[model samples]
Target: MSKAVIEFTDFSFTYRAQQEPTLRGINLSIREGEKVLIVGPSGSGKSTLAHCINGLIPFYYPGETAGSLRIMGQEQQEQSIAALSQTVGTVLQDPDGQFVGLTVGEDIAFVLENAAVPLQEMKERVTAAARAAGIGDLLSASPQELSGGQKQKTMLAGVLAGNVDILLFDEPLASLDPFTGTRTIEHIDRLQRETGKTVIIIEHRLEEVLHRPVDRIIIMNDGVIACDLPPAELLSSGLLAGTGLREPLYLTALRYAGVAVTPDLQPQHPELIRLEGAAQRLEQWVDGYREQSGPAEAVPLLELKEVTFGYERETAVLDKLSLTVNRGEMLAIAGRNGAGKSTVSKLICGFYKPSSGSIWLNGRDIGRDTIKERAERIGFVMQNPNHMLSKTLLYDEVAFGLKLRDVPEELIRERVHGVLRICGLHAFREWPISALSYGQKKRVTIASILVLEPEIIILDEPTAGQDYRHYNEMMEFLRGLSSRGITVIMITHDMHLMLEYAQRAIVLADGKKAGDDRPERILTDRSIVEKANLRETSLYTLALRAGLQQPEELVRTFIAFDREVRRR
Candidate 1:
């Protein structure tokens, strides 16, 4: 008999905030030692369901839940969250949000101390957890000092210290870079293998998470248990798309080639060959990217020539690096955490001056320019939206930049309203910044800059923490800007986002340039993928693994060509 680690029997829940229940008649059974992937779209009750399992339902969130839930053979109601801690451990979205200790070591030791474990034993436990999370060197470092990926690992260390049998991972890889994300996945896998723990991963980055060897894939939609199947079965099903989930890019690609259930099950190599040829055709058919001379036509609206800079002249974050962003270009900068993508933006904004190399603006060196001087021309948006909102109200926040520039009040109002509409924040322009969702706050940041009418915009991971809908809206807005001759430079870890939004990609590895090319070309290059510690996109990998000839083409019904075919 299989041990049911987490069993939800016709469970239902209603939040105090909403008239309708968030979770309706949910029935799920996760067996011991099984690796399960919970896939869902935004607002799909995934977080709610996860909270319920880990004892956050009645304890933290106000709600009425019916039916029986068993965690570690104990009814969920029978055990307190503290008691349940012995059975299940949870790692949340923002690892930094969960930090309680000042140092990483202290953080990992927290649960042990909470459980009243002896000092000597707690020390051993903390050491093991830190080792497992791959942050042994960061023990004394403050959790505040860690990168997004490092913070997540530190949180995992905290959870691992509890020595629980079931682990709950909620969007663990969302903020992680390709290398760190994969490493985290590997650690999770190894931890499960060694300890025989049941791991439940709730993630929206399905393609990456599901690519692993999971026992089953459980899908949630509209607060309902839509499907429970093996990973292969879920991969082969079109239900993900049908349920309004953004299916993995690979699955989307295969579907494009007209490969339905059968072709997916037993991939057709000949069709893949055709698909590859088709991909090449798409590249060749890129009529819009006509050959331009020098780096000038390559000449971006913003140019950095041999730029190098540092804070106080010790260690340069950027080592004399040079880059260019053409007018109307969407350029993506990718690298592991702390690889200077953000610093590059700061350099362009003149927040820090180059020690040696010159930065060119419209072919003129602006290396010694002030941030204010650069700001008049370029807009730099940081990752954290809250930090950027200067005013209390959305309308005021959007208009803040232009107001600082001393634009006429009438013009500021007019342009702010226009940009709010374009950025999809018009309805909430009068609302307080405190009332804004993370996605909404992010859009407000973009609008704040857009109203300034900067010729070049640099966004640092614009799509971070966003759902597919928000992601699409943000990218679509950026696309419109690019069309109007604004050069969009994004520092991001999302390979798919780069592939779709950016016309060109520049990869920085080990603090230097590894690639500068179209995303299609960059992604197809194995050397680049290897150097960056990125796994192939699921569709690309599936096509490769399944021995397809034109894997990329057959993957999407080949969207671009299909659209062309439709138009023809």
Candidate 2:
């Protein structure tokens, strides 16, 4: 008795300039009130399919299409974009880009104003929506002044005010920390359940989106629907890896321990996935596992002494924080949102001068150094790839840094080409930057910095919106940099990245150094993990559930096993 909210019949679309169809014969139906998660590798047409439903493909992108696409049982070609907006509400990846008003309440009201709604009713709707999204108190706050999570809530309130029955979230968790992401997903799930709305979430973080109960999981690959089934069936099909999507960490751990996962196993909920004989098998495996890391040989590459800074003098984002980065170290700055992780990177890059602190670069004070001078030694890649891309062509974008440094044309070309190959962007050398996807644009930014050959590289959420293939390529490239004596620091909220890539993790809580040690040691300390709002990996949870003698060994073993498996 489920009503079909969206229906696609032999739907295929190709851009005006391209010959290949982005979506090839997509025949899918999403029922009303169904919660679905759509996932795929980058360039796999997930986003394209989302655009089609929201009326962005034909209206905004100007694509050549064939076959029938319907929203609310109405053919897409018959309805205008503005008309379709009433039925479909989209919360985009970048909340800032969607904002049109100065204050949170005003932003929520702006959409209502466009629809010619009365002033009194608009006010009532905005308040109700804000309260629903749990941002009622932030109504008076400026949209620009709100935190990332708050901004997203503001957008959600705006969407809810539209009173749309079909909600589409595009990478909602990409820019959020673990705690905020979890809460946001839960809130969205509640909205869906309470309203009987059709919700379709397009995200790369499969496991995080699985926090809520998903009715179905749709896997896409190369413009085709690879698999569409219930969550348990999709996880048990063993088709995720082949489709270039990441399986849950707990499932990976179980497989590593030689446990056969059945449909009865809840892969998404690690704590709930109890196999009859799996605990004994995992315990035995952990008992035989040993740590491979040795004691750190300290050699300071960069040092921060008593740093203190804040946008407002009343509150310090970073207060008297001291840290050291050793040579050839791959370190992670781990903390909750607003815990000064990005602030630390900015201070190190000389973007902001510390109010009271000294930054030493190779035994020399860098406090007085200009940003340009600091840039010669330290390279920083921003979290948003669009902010970093300036040139139209991929080659030009990658060679921009070298050009700025007055590197000879010949050398710039050679270095750009070399870095492009390393970052997996060589094939797109002549392509327009606008034509490339978000993941490809991120690689261009990294290549642009890598060509500079800096002694230290700092990346702010480098893999935020990337798929498994691009994420692995970028991480593997960064790993290679660490092996060549470069000091690399990653400011991230991704627990998987912290546990797997970061050799050492520096935990920050309330602008103070909480823990600085091996990632395993830092993560295993439940106090520090909670203080920083970091998620405990399923591997750790599995170890505890199985009553393993050394839970730390499970962490070590999972890291080793994951790396080896990725190597293949």
Candidate 3:
């Protein structure tokens, strides 16, 4: 029998500023050596539950709490956060915020130093943790200079150095690419097995987290536990889609092809999931598939001609790259980390100047234009929403740009409210920015940029950590913008978003143009997908398993089917 590591009994919590409770009557228990996933839509109290476990509810956020809660067989209320830290080590969404030392080795040893360990013991613990995380070579490197995956490993090393038995990961894969995300999950799984730690992962990306086997999935909605079941049972129940959360893409594809999920199937590892008559159903679907008409002739809105740029003189981030964004088109720029995806956006926004080539907006060259001047025509929404938001209130932030342009007061109100409604921030217009969640703050940033009415919008992973509902709403809003003649260029690592919404996609590999074509073509090409480190959608795999000659064609049919389902 396993020992219970966390227990909650009829617990409820409410913020001081709000009238309604965020979490109510929650009862849960997690045992040692168990790996569990917690998923929910936005504003679903998932974070609130995590906060309660980490002692952030009453201590940091100052919320009203009731009922019994225990961690490691001790009453939560009786333990201080400092005391809880010894048992529960949390890896936050942003690893940069958790670092305390300049170098990787120093950061991992910082926890040991606080415990008054001897110098030799501290070094020993740091070395062991770094080796366990497979980041021993990065010990001398600066933490801030590491890549997203390396930074995450460093954070994990710090937690391991503390000798914690309970590990909590809060959206650990949100900032990583698909390849890196897969490796990170593997590392976490290895640590859990070797140390027998209770692993709880709070994430919106359910598929990636399930790369390893999870004992259970706990679905929360409206402050209540909606479903708690083992992975196989949960997938078979079909409750994931009903809860407004995304079911795994492979499972979704199987359902669309008329294949039922089996009781013993694993959704995360698609190769292992087997359904009776799956091949026949997929073959039939492909036989009846019809391709939609291609996109109409596009008029160029933004043009890059032989662009070459590099931070240093000898190294070029983007070398002799040429591309075009058509008016009213949605283009996705995709690649692994350091593939010049964001560099392309930076050049368009005037953050970096191209060394050899020129950039043109409409017909005029804008290579030498200032960022402020380019801001009028091109709006860039960064990955971190907090970096873009300046105003205290949501409404003020959305309206600030128009006010600066000296627009009429009446027109400003009209534009601000309109953009807020489109971005789904109209309801939170009066709320303070600090009171809003990270996802809500991201919407505010998009609204702030949208109210400027720029001809071209460049969003850097706009849906990076967003829930399904928010992602759908935001993508629909961007689609609406494209219909109204606004060019939208999305720099993202999300394969689903790229395949579904982007009519045209540009694949970047080693700072060069790898493939520029329809998203379907770019993803189906083995060389381009592998070189760019992008994952092919499960639809393609299902096509191959169904023995179809043209897998890409069948994949396009799945995309069409999904688009039609959303329309309904």
Q: List the lowest-lDDT window of 10 residues for candidate 1.
A: 266-275
- Model 2 lDDT per residue over 361-432, tens place: 899998889999999889999989999988888999888888887999999999998888878788889999
Q: What is the TM-score of each candidate against the true structure?
A: 0.84, 0.97, 0.97
| 398-489 per-residue lDDT for model 1 (tens digits) | 88777777889998888988888877778777788875545668788877887887888999878766666657666787877887888889
What ordering of candidates by TM-score runs from best to worst?
A: 2, 3, 1
Worst 10 residues of 2 by lDDT: 287-296
Global lDDT of each candidate: 0.76, 0.89, 0.88
lDDT value for model 2: 0.89
Candidate 2: deviation at residue 17, Å? 1.9
Q: Name the TM-score of candidate 2.
A: 0.97
Winner by lDDT between candidate 2 and candidate 1: 2
Per-model RMSD to reference? 4.8, 1.4, 1.5
After superposition, candidate 2 runs with Cα above 4 Å error: 291-296
Per-residue accuracy of model 3 over 347-372 as CA lDDT, tens digit each:
99999889999999989999778999
